[model samples]
Target: MISRPYDEIKLLIENYLKKEFSTKSDLIWSKPPSVELGDISFPLFNIAKELKIKPEELSEKIIAEISFPDIVEKVNLQGGFLNLTFNRSIFVTQVLQTILEQTKYGQNSSLSSERIIVEHTSSNPTGPLHIGNFRGSVLGDVLGRLFSFLGAAVNVRYYVNDLGRQIAPLVIGYFLLKEAKYKIEEKGDLWLGKVYASMYTFLEIQQLKQKLSMLGWKIKDSSVSLYRLDDTDLKTVPEFLNSLPKENEEKDNTHKWFMKLTRIQSSLIERIPEVYEKLNKLTSSKIENLESTTNQYVKNYQEGKDKLIVEKFREVTKIALDGHVETLNLFAIFHDDFDWESDVAWSGEVQTMLAELEDKKYLRHDEKARLLKNDIIAEELGYKTKYSISYEIPDTIIINSEGITLYPCRDIVYHLHKLEKFNASQCYNVIAKMQQLPQLSVRLALYGLNRTDTADRIHHFDYEYVSLIGRKMAGREFDYVTPDELFVLAQEEIKTIIEERNYSEEEQQNIANKIAASSIKYHILKMDPQKSVAFDVKKAVDPNENSGSFLQYSYARALSILSRSSKHDINVQKILESTEKENLIIEKQAEWELVKLMEELPSILIKAAKSLRPDSVANFSYSLASSFHKFYDACPVLKAETPELIKSRVRIVFSISKCLESLFEVMGIEALEKM
Candidate 1:
């Protein structure tokens, strides 16, 4: 409803300027700083300067030349600015009526026919997701919802990295641990997480031994405790060896190896206690065999030759994905497709892509590996200076020395497949900021293929990391917090707040879960994508703070008001359509302010969608909730002096509730009727 009048005003101003000045200008409108001024303001300084006339005189002439429609009640010129005020009573009534009639009042149809794909949360299937990955999940999920609300044919996808180096170790660890009869009763992903960490520690110890042996140092006691490195005198070995003072060259060599050993030992001591026992159980021969087996597993899986290895990989990957799905369900995140990296390799899509590149003369084979010759393509696309800082552009490697396809190469095939399969014109990869270079390389590869349409439409919705207590979380470290853990913690906190309420046990649990999930989502999404979030669960669930629960509680409060009014047998429809001017009176400043905030919803939605930032909508939700609270405090609904006043206030409350519902829908927030 607001967009209609806003568009009408823009067209009116554009046509008026073309006729008056015999030239055209881009007419941009902004809101007045204060509600008392006007609904929209248009600055006249630019046009005034172009016409070589004083802005004050230009504003006056424009005010006299153009006539506002019935919707625009008054036009005032303040200095060099032209402000237009709407008929508040009529605009509010009409907007409320339209919101009541339309199921989706704030949605627009500008991109109704365009197809888009939003791929996100493509975490490797080696472990459960930490909070860092959850940030991207929330961002992508909200974007999918926002684009769909704006009438785009959006498909959400998750690219599973099932054929990466991480998966190799996961498979090896599962088999090795199963042979040891290690039983895990927890989530499979969590169990795999422990195994993966232990494997890394074991591998590190083996590498350290090889480094020591190269320096002619042998360990006489394999029974020495690997866990007590903190009490071991590793530094003394380097010092004693250095003090021997043999030939300068030999002395330096001994110093180097001992220092390297000390560093490795220090790293080993830093590992969690569980990794120590795993490392102690790994003999040198077993470690060597495990390394060879991991390589064989990857090779056979890639070549599609080993059925047992393939099935083992799939079984473990399915366990990890099951855990992923469970966590995603807690946040209400669903994807239209789950694209496996192995599928790109198995379906011959990757080979087909390589063949096409070779046909286009973009593929080159160096002595060590096959590479995509992007230097010519980069120059052709102006990538060196256009895409990023001039000194940061690097050539992309398509395949390594072992004839294995890299992730970026596989990503290129995956993206092209998505475009061809879905016929989508736009694709957004909601990945972390650390992968900016890889993402850029993929886009360059697309451009190199002369697929400029796909290249130009590829958007990297890059976001920064999410940290807890100034420490970033990594899944492989086994020290990070999981989304499931955070959900449990949030529920415990929310339970304490709602325990005294008269709700049943089941109702209490439901409310706690929704509030907990909402709090987590809001905390992750309330900030700009480019900024890092220091997550604090306590502040996130507080009803007094500008949190998700606060917004939900605000809606619930409005519902409570309306529920009370229903008992009075008030005819809401009759009150909304009342023709009596005095009965429609909104003399309170708070009511007018709330109406103004409600009127900005359509414009806010359009801006948020265009900017690809859900934070804008989140910020708007907070402001709307704040305004509603202010109105509730200042104006009385059921306690009004007259029946008409009560109806008027109720109408405003109902409109606020509707607008909030629309906003929550776009933000992927659950709007609760009771909290």
Candidate 2:
């Protein structure tokens, strides 16, 4: 509601500057440090500097030149700043009435006709989603909600990476351990995750052996069978390995040896020795042949030459995706599209993209593979190269020696398909920070192909990793907690909270599930996208903390208050109209502060939407909740001094509740009516 008046003030300033001084400058507005100072402040330093005048003089001159509108109660010059105070009673009435009149108060039509596609949570189907992956899902889902709230034609997509190298080892492990049985009821992705971990560990051991062979050191069969060697003997092996070095220095023998040792240590800590034993019992193939077989399967699947192998691979992927869907549904996430990498590969889009790049002279042959010419792309895009001390650009390989297209190549095709098929004007890929380079390469490639418009519209909504508060996670070692596990932990905490309630078992379960989902989602979304999150279950589920539960509790408390006031038979519209006439004033500081905070919602939403920062909204919600709590404590609504005062306070409470519910909806959180 205040956003409209704020924008009008900015426009008025801009027009006055252009006409009076024949100069243009950005009119930045900020809030006063305290309510007594003013409602908004504009610094005159920049304009004064440009016009070669004193800031105090310029401020006075501008205030004298511009006419004060009805909303502007007073304009005063304090030091070098111009401060404007609004008519408090009029401002409060306008803000409250706007909230009651418009259901979509904060929504703007700036991007009403624009089409947007947000691709997120494109994790490989080899395992269940860990808490780290959940960050991207929540971020993407919230972005989609925000865009939709702002009237954009939004489509959410999940890009399934079923055709990647990560899935090859998973497929091989499944084939080897198909008959293995466990008593626990495991989800398909969880089962595949165990197999992946085992296969990866076995491959690591084999690679270590191969490295030792290249160093002319042979381990006896008896030595290989042992789980651990004596510490003294193990320490001696590192010194011996360091004594040898290759002439070219390309292969650091000592470093490789230490890395291999580290892997073995990690495997032990992750209990991979037991997994390896199970894998050994299931497979009779020599370690040396594993890679070749995995490669053969990948090749045949890509070429569609072996129907049985391809079908089996698809079957496993289907099961994994089914699990993915169930997990996503727990958070109330539903995608409009689920795109597959194999579909892009088989649809000739990858081939067509390659052909176009070749025709544009952006492709070059390098080491028997087609590579994107980085120098040519850099020159064509007019990008000045700045050499970073720790960074270097490597050529993007479109196709490898084995005639299989790499992930980035497929991704470029996928992005192009998204723009054309959805008629999208903007697209956001909510991937991890690790993929920043690849995303940049794709954007550069698109620019080289004369698709600068598309390149400009593409966004990499990158975020850092999420870890446990006191624990580290290794995805390849299967040493991380899955989202399902986090959910269970959250539910346990919530169950303890509601154990003494009078609800049925079914109702308790439903409440616990909602609270659990909100707990995780709110904590992740509360952090800036660039910052790594150390997730703590206890902190997130606390009802009194700055969390989703607190927001929900505030909303529920507001509802309870409203229910108790049924005897008054309050009419919100009638109260809003009579607010000024009855002089039902905001006498308390807490009351005025709450009203002002509520007035900032529309502006906050605009900023959050423009900056693509959901953290801003999360933070704003916390502030509003805090201010409302303060008002509730200081001012009585039902037992106020006058009926008009009670009506005024009730209106404020109602607005706060509505605002919070709207925010919770956009953040993908459930606003519970009861905790």
Candidate 3:
């Protein structure tokens, strides 16, 4: 029921096709690079097929014949496309009227009421979050907001891997080494790396090796052998596409062992960037580093910095191969290390299922199984190479239980449990872009609804790493400042900036918040989920075209225009039809171009929500802000004295303010109360 300029434009286009060419399909509306290029573009790509004429001729003819309203400034043809520029005064007047009056200007039901749950952070409870693990937290949280704004009932939850081997070692690490504190050493980037690395020595490796030998994987064989997966046609696939093991060992492949590897990798890759940022505080190197400032703590036991410990830890990992048991923190270590009589294991009651092709039989063997997937099953279902994921049946693993031979239950349980716990509509898990195809196939093969409580649903949100340049910024390793630390630096910078500018405290805070929030959100949201980002605080905080301040100022300028006007009361539907410089502030294409931008709020909100990309909203707001600024410089509203013209411009400014306010909040940004 809501009206939009795009909606109005769509109607006009449909009518044009029907009346001019007797055609049926709607010409999709397109946006050219600049506002001057066009408000809406129609490529004759589709229409050319229906009409015998070439696209260029059709575009020129359409441009000449189209009957546009007075508010529409002019129609032009370029690059075989029809471009439009709207009259500024009318555009501004209509925009102010529509946004101010609409009950929901920028909302969409694109997702309707889909139940979605987004799980993020899921960081351990033991230590402070530190900057490394913050992206998943921010990305997931922002996606939840985007979904809600798009008309979804979204639930955001944090998963704690509390019941794991990773927890136990940390607890034991604390007990084994008391007054265990880490100090930032030198002006180097990764201050905590050496100390955290040294703590791996305390684990039991001898027992782990024996256990891995029981798991039927010899260290040497695991290190060297490769598992090759084939296509559905049994065509051999290339073997050059997998990560090599860190060493030759059965334990390296175990899920538990992988967890430790991942944890270390994540910390180094994810958290190090933020962690390394503390170095900037001593940018001049005149001040002492973190380590020199604090006394080295005494330990309960003398832990040697030696290589034997690393080897033994690797040996134990090879044996247990279960991060759940071997790499556990204190609680997980205690529970998993116990004899059967000592403790009960924790497993959720959710039942698991695997799809069985009814018509085909799976041939079972000693180490794997194979079966055929009927291509017919996906014929009408729209599952194919373009939009489909398929899995090749593997050679079955065989195991004997009580003299009865069957598939390996150990392998089955391992994959089943992990697949069943996928916490989103899409069983969302973070996979590096490098593993996209393989991981997606795994999801397709193990599809099922993961039931949650009445109010629970799964949501997936992704973000790029805050990077220094092109490389992904890992926690302290990336050497990017944490938001908390950034705040302090910002404070000092603000003091200097304010003193230089002769600005007030409020001005400093506003500028700081504008820049900081821009840096934080853009750094986290701008990249594709699968791609890792490198961070550069200086680039992120830059206030030129890309920075958040530009948008803030744009919104403030619109407000300033609105505040200065006395004639606020006016009807939105009143269309102005004038073309003078005095009236150009309202009549020029720039004015209505901004108005049309205001009209897109709900749709953009909905789109960004569905994409789970808060950056889309951030990006859109910036464009809207940019358009308004262009309007202000080219057209002077205060210069308009006619009662009708002044009233129209006032309403336009009011509408722009309302739209900006709603969007800024969604982007986790603030519209500057004053410029």
Candidate 4:
């Protein structure tokens, strides 16, 4: 375990207060405004009041009476405040020695007894994951990593939404377009995405044409009675057409929408002409039954009434999901389990829950769907006031008239499944902000069903969208960059940088791949989860500053220094052992600043875990790297004037490398020995 110097130092002061004043102090600690003032400070106003001594006088008494530990160099009394400066030599030795002694230096048992389930990136298996989906994936994976680092038993799962409206188009397209001759140059998910997008666009175009035709007929009908006239009306067709309603807003709007659909259709056709042509034929033949077919496929699959349809649904979904898994594996992001929505739907758990809720009078039926009585539950539990909720929460649809289960209900059942499967104490669903209502409704449904304990433990780990500049993504239209495309874009940017380095083509490509992955992951993880990210690939991969590549570059630089040093120059054991007899001085200000920044890693990890924000850790790693760069620029490790200084600086570099490696593991970034 790494020693927490700040915490230990604070405890030492508390003991001093107890010994001198015979009183316990709830001490508040903060850094001095300037480094020259001291390392840590606390006020004497409250303690002086308790001891019946003026604060100014008390400060002097404490300085005279206090027994400073080896960790504290001295204490300064400034009016009512006491400032303690650390013995830099001892402080530096402790931080480095403790970090070297531990396997995972900053890990703690803070969540040792906790059993947690984190479900993220459960995008419907309709298409490949876009940049938006990648954000949640990285966030969730990093979260699981952080919790595990905190000694929690964490299970990271991906909820496969195998059965939903989103997947219906893909299923229909699989059979209808299987024999169609479209190019298969892209990955499975990308190709399937085009199929899905083409299906929707084609259907929309068909519907728009029919609508325009009907509106035109209505205009002609309004101008003349077709049943009353024959040859005269026909010969005067131009006159009657002129009499048609000229300022119809609905017709104008319909034309506008038709134009828009045509654009989307054109783009889809351009990408996959065979798919568009086949869809056109299918629609022209019997498009009226497309809806019924889609609904029937969903119903049959859900009820397990048709084995062939169910197999096809699973097959298509698996292909898309496999593509997703492959793309995420590039960045080292993975899930411990893939929990299927259909599996939970078919397990009889949803039905059993519905039966139980019905028995308990929590379930009710409306004209449109079966709803859970959320209002009654909220009133009974006083959730409005208890949880400080301001808005009204309406009843949530558990099952629609088509006999298909909705998301919230299936989600509730899945939560129970996860909880029981792992016997987890809490379940976290990492979904987008758009699903807040549904997420809350899941909790309300659980509460209404007399499982308030389980309801309270369910967490909606929500986040905002991630958009690429100048890129508009419509999932149904398939007009977005997949993770594969994003990675390619990143690799292209990196190629320009590493091409001039002393590496072969293969090595350069490998380095580009690693840097690209780190750039994307760090960019997403460095932002506040509640804030949307407008990701810039160039900024993400910038090696100059404040990026993952910069951090990696810093680590590689440290490794380079260590590689060039002799065994005697890099011996940390002798220095640490000698610290007991005498101080190991850190002479340079840059060195001292760097050591102080490294000391905060443990506290930073704890704060991030407790606050559910990985950005804190991301930002801290950047600061640490930036500080190391400054130290390296200011001090020469290999060319030091004395062998002792060289040995000390080498140890600093080694400790920093270890610190960075641990953080890389937590952030899912690759630590490159060479870049």
Cα RMSD for candidates in order: 3.6, 3.7, 14.0, 5.3
Residue 92: error of model 2 in Å?
0.7
Q: Give the per-residue Cα lDDT of candidate 3 at 102.
A: 59
- Residues 1-675 of candidate 3: C-alpha lDDT, one tens digit per residue: 435666676677678778878986567877878876877777777787778778888877776777777766777778667777766655554555556565546655666546455545544333333344555555555565566666666554433333333333333333232222335342221222322332221122222333444654353433211111113101211121123344636434544543343344345434444332222222113222122211111111112133444343333322222322221221111121111100111121111222232222222233334322223322323334534546432332222322221212212222344323333243233222343333333332222112222112211233444444554433312233444454344444445544666567777776665555544555555555656665555554444434466776777788777555545443333432232234424566676677777777777787666555666776787788788888788777756656665556656666677787777656556567664
TM-score for candidate 2, residues paired by index: 0.90
Candidate that beats the other on lDDT, 1 or 4, i.e. the better one: 4
Residue 264 displacement in candidate 1 (angstroms) = 10
> Residue by residue across 507-573, what tens digits does model 1's lDDT show?
9999998888888788778889999878765565454463788888889999888887766777666
lDDT per residue as tens, model 2, 1-675: 344566778789878988889876677888889777888899888888889999898888888888977778988888888999987776777677778767766766767988999999988898888878878998999999888888899999999998887677778778666656533258888777777776665555555655555666555532333223335436645665666664636247546655655665556446755555666555444333566667887877776668898887898898888888888889887788889887777777778788889899888887668888765676557542422223345677878876678888888887766787689989999999999878877877887778778887889999999878786777677778777877887888888888988888998899899988887778778899999878775676554453777777778788777777756676555665564554336779898888888887887887888999978888898888888888888998877888768878888888888888778878888988777
Number of backbone-clashing residue pairs for each candidate, in the order shown = 0, 0, 69, 0
**Model 4, poorest ten-residue lDDT window?**
221-230
TM-score of each: 0.90, 0.90, 0.60, 0.89
What's the alpha carbon RMSD for model 3? 14.0
Q: List ranges where model 2 is wrong by over 4 Å.
A: 1-3, 180-184, 217-276, 285-288, 383-393, 500-502, 541-546, 567-584
Off by over 4 Å in 4: 14-26, 43-65, 77-81, 181-183, 206-260, 270-274, 282-288, 382-386, 401-403, 541-546, 567-580
What is the C-alpha lDDT profile of model 4 across 1-675, one tens digit per residue? 545788887777677888877865576677788889988887887888888889888778777876677889878876677888998988987887788777776878899999999988998787899878888898898998999998999998988988787567568776666645444676888778877887666545445544544655343443232111224433443343444577865655664664576567667667667766676675445445455566777788777668899889988989899999998999899998888888888888887888888887877888657888877777777666668777667887888886667877788887665787778998888889888888887888777677778888888888998776776777766677676876887888888888788999999999999988888788778999999877665566455543878888999999888776654355545543454444456889999999988888888899999999988889999999999999999999888878768767877888899899889988989998888
Q: Which of the predicted structures, 1 or 3, would earn the higher TM-score when compared with the native?
A: 1
Q: Runs in model 3 with CA error above 4 Å?
A: 15-26, 31-39, 54-90, 124-133, 176-198, 201-345, 348-442, 448-467, 470-481, 499-515, 528-531, 541-546, 560-592, 609-613, 634-646
Angstrom error at residue 283, model 3? 34
